[model samples]
Target: MHWKEYIKRMPLEVKQITGPLVLGEGPHWDDRVQALYFVSIHEKTIHKYNPASGEHTKTTLDGRPGFIVPVEGALDQFLVGLEREFVVLQWDGAEGSAVKFVRKIGEVDQDATKNRINDGKADPRGRIFGGTMGDEKSPGDFAQEQGSLYRVDGNITRVADKIGISNGLAWDLSAKAMYYIDSLEQNVRRYDYDVDTGDISNMRHIFNFPKNGLDGFPDGGTIDTDGNLWIAVFNNGVVIQVSPEGKLLRQIPIPAKQVTSCTFGGPNLDILFVTTSHYMNKPGEGDPQDGCTFMVTGLGVKGHPNVNFKF
Candidate 1:
């Protein structure tokens, strides 16, 4: 079937859940707790939403949170990318619960004060693959190639360096291939992954934005059960679905621009939860739904369970 025809048959329903954030990023669904978790980077806050009860709560953090992932065997504990350091966060998800910084597991870019962690995800085996980006005070203006990608398990290992804007990560169901995005490059790269050792090699570009006629930089992404990638495009107001072979399968238009990240959530894991940013936009300039977290449903697909850090 033609890509457009296939997409036309798929019914889509999008709804805004949480909103008006300052740079909302990183949406992770905790199946164990049946809740959705995400962070607003510039706001330095972590948010949790319970769909069953329609309850939304946020906890302010001391530093910018690039991403958050649940820790294995501990529901209240999470590993967060806090500025330049990877810290263990303890929060009970209670209303106005006090948050605690348990300890710092690892730190990156010690000499580069301007760099901070960006997007991250855990491999099927529970090892974290996180990356950082250089000082980016404004859109399209950042220190190029000052960031690096690191694999965190027992130790921190720099798997790749010279990154422009580290964003989006996903491992295939078989754990044999990894998909990554560096927004500045406007492309998605595939890597041969080793699940046992947390190593990646043989990197190759799988998707190019301009070549495919896509408008904005590719931001955060997640993989469906079919191994297709759903990527949020910054400044494009769309989430695109790309086949494993790098074919443009579908373009899911969002109501707001500055779409940052997305993840599969909900009881059946068929819902795609997306996050957007309000960075640099004046109050009356952009869409009212800007910086809101949205839920895209009825795609007729499901995603794997959220991976947790082994630590």
Candidate 2:
């Protein structure tokens, strides 16, 4: 079926949660705290929102944050990809609270000073998997193939290389498959995953954006309980849902032009929280909701809970 038909059948109810950031990305829902955490990379800030109370709070950081994930045992501590380093951060989510850096877990691309960590997540076993992107000369222009993907399990190990704008990642536990996206490639690759040892192999392209008549590159992604992948398409203003077999199932339109990433949240994990970017928007240009975080509902699916970083 065509994407337009899918949109017609599914009338998604989207609501803006919080707004007008420089670049809003990396969304994670903490079920334990019943709150949502996300980052605005260029603004150097981390935001927390409680759905129940409609309270939004944020703390500024010294460096740009790529992603934020909760720590397994520490409720108040988190593992953040800050610039090129993976560091432990402690923030109590209080308004006007200060964020303390505990220690640096590791750093990537030390030699490539221009490269920085981009997007990341923890595997089912609690190992942190993150990727880096080369220098961004301008919007949609980057130093190609100077980045790599890394697995952090106490020690940082390079899993894949020759990446340009390394982006989305999702894992299917039942199928032992890992889905990855290098945004510049405009395609999604599936790898044979080894859950026990945190290994991935036998990579093959599963979904191609241009070939499938899609407009933008694939960005951050999350998996549903049924193993379907919901991918955010950067510059496309929509998120596409693909089946395990690589077939497009639906396309949900977003108001913001630069939709960066998305994840499922809410009490039942049924709400899709989308993050947008205002990276290249000039003063008084583009939509007013360009850098807002939106909550999408009415989709009949539940997502797996986010995995916390063990160390």
Candidate 3:
């Protein structure tokens, strides 16, 4: 498809949410439930958005929730990364249903409060991999070498020590490589990912942004069915579509200052759902546009199905 045609096909209406959202990220679309699962880390909230009925429901958490994903083997289970610990949590947010403890962090800090888990996803092999951001004051602080990427499976954990601001992660099917972002460094790194062992190697930088005119940092992202990487740029309020080889294919400009994450959804995968934030910067003349949810037509990027809980 021609790139010009793609822009012409932008969706008619971008959905707006009622929010003064703080630190929004990690959007997952559940096709079976016809809902979008997203996190507002600062609010310590998980929200469910149903398009068909225009119904939105939010559930609060005790700990600042970072990334949330379903179990790969169990249909009814889910995992949540809270500030201080990882937990097997019931989707309902019940008081006694959160199974957690301050186990040694498989790869990094022991105190969750010292670091915040950012973007994460399950590999085809069913392991969850993500990293954390250290406690910092920048609206979305991406600095701190203490932030390390992690892999969690069963009782064992693996940590990659050279990481900083571990955010945005996904994989390619044929090559089985892992694509990850170091949001703080303004770079995206690729790895020779070992799915079965949850190990990564040949780690090297592939791309970095915030070039001459860009304002945002890199945030969360997704891999399209075609293996392209769609990354949200933090301060810039834009999403960039890139080829697996680290080439920029195109860009989608958004009104929000923080384009925290992006996911492809809807029946045909032509819809792109972006989660934004209301946490940073002085409101521009059009600041309200920055935090609203955006949907654009003709993305042509179909996302992989969310990993389900294995029972």
Q: Give the per-residue lDDT digits (tens) of candidate 2, residues 1-311.
A: 85335434676699999978988988999989989999999889989999999999999999999999999888889999999999999999987699998989998998899998899999999999999999988866799999999999979999999999888889998999999989989999999999999999999999989889999789998999989999999888999999989999999999998999999999988889999998978777899999899999878788999888897
- By summed lDDT, the worst window of 10 consecutive residues in model 1 runs over 2-11
Tens digits of lDDT, candidate 1, 156-220: 99999999999999989574999999999999999998887878899999999999998889999
Clashes of each: 0, 0, 17
**Residue 123 lDDT, candidate 3, scale 0-100:** 75
lDDT score, residue 113, model 1?
91
- In the predicted model 1, the residue pairs found to clash are none
Alpha-carbon TM-score of each model against the true structure: 0.95, 0.95, 0.85
- For every candidate, C-alpha RMSD to the true structure in Å: 3.0, 3.7, 4.0
Where model 1 places Cα greater than 4 Å from the true spot, the runs are: 1-10
Ranking by lDDT: 2, 1, 3
Candidate 3 lDDT over 96-208, as tens digits, reads 24443323334346644477777677777767776777777666454567677777776536467656677888888688688888777788888887766767889888776
